[model samples]
Target: MNHLEYVTCGTCSRLITIDVDAAGIIRNLSFLGGCSGNLKGICALAIGKPATEIKNTLKGITCGSKDTSCPDQLATALEQMGY
Candidate 1:
C-alpha cells in the first residue's frame, strides 16, 4: 500500500490524499479545503471501490465556472498514481 498526496488546481480544495491497495482498490480518501459535506460523501462512496472506476466516473467533471472540480481533481490524482 502507498499513500499519495495530490495538490489540486482550480478548485476550492487545496489537496487530496489517497490510499490504494494492491488490487487497485481505494482504501481511503480525503480532501482538504473543499465542500465539507460533499467531500465526506465522496470519501464514503470512494472507499473500497476500484480506482479505475472512480477515475472514469469523475475525470471530466467541471465546477460551474472553473475548469475542474474537486471530483475531477481526485480523478487526476488517481491517474497520476497509474490507476
Candidate 2:
C-alpha cells in the first residue's frame, strides 16, 4: 500500500489524504477543514474503490459557480500523483 496526501486549492478544504493499494484501489481516505459530514461520507464511499474510478466520477464536479470543488480537487490530486 502507498499513502498519498494533497493540499487542495481553490476550495473550502485544506487537505486530502488517501491510502491506496498497488492496483490503485483506495484503502482509506480523509480530508481536513471542509464540510465535515459530507467529507466523511465521501471518504467512506471512496474506500476500497479504484482511484481512476473515483477521479472519473468526480473530475468535473463544481460547487455552485466555482470552477472546482473538493471532489474535483481530489481527482486533480490523484491525477498529479499518477493514479
Candidate 3:
C-alpha cells in the first residue's frame, strides 16, 4: 500500500492521511480538526473507493462560498499522490 499524509490548504480541516493500493483504491482515511460527523462520513465514503473517483467527485466542492472545502482538499491531496 502507498501512504500519504497531507496538510490541507484553505479548508476547515488541518490534515488528511490516507493509504491506498496500487490500483488507487483507498485502504484507510482520516481527517483532523474538522466537523467530526461530516469528516467521519467523508472517511466512510472514501475508504475502499478509488482515489481518482473520489477526486473527480469532490474536486470542485466548496464550503459556504470558500473556494475549497475538506472534500476539495482531499481531492487535491489525492492529486498530489499522483492519482
Give the per-residue lDDT digits (tens) of candidate 1, residues 1-83: 96899999999999999999999999999999989999999999999999999999999999998989999999999999999
Tens digits of per-residue lDDT for model 2, 10-76: 9999999988889999888899998999899998888989999999999989998899999999999
Residue 60, model 2, lDDT: 89
What range of 10 consecutive residues in model 2 has the weakest lDDT sum?
A: 74-83
Which lDDT value does model 3 have at 63?
A: 96
Residue pairs that clash (backbone atoms under 3 angstroms), model 3: none
Candidate 1 runs further than 4 Å off: none
Full-model lDDT for every candidate: 0.96, 0.90, 0.94
Who is ahead in TM-score, 2 or 3?
3
Encode model 3's per-residue lDDT on 2-27: one tens digit a residue: 89899998887899999999988999
By summed lDDT, the worst window of 10 consecutive residues in model 1 runs over 1-10
Whole-model lDDT for model 3 versus the true structure? 0.94
Best by lDDT: 1
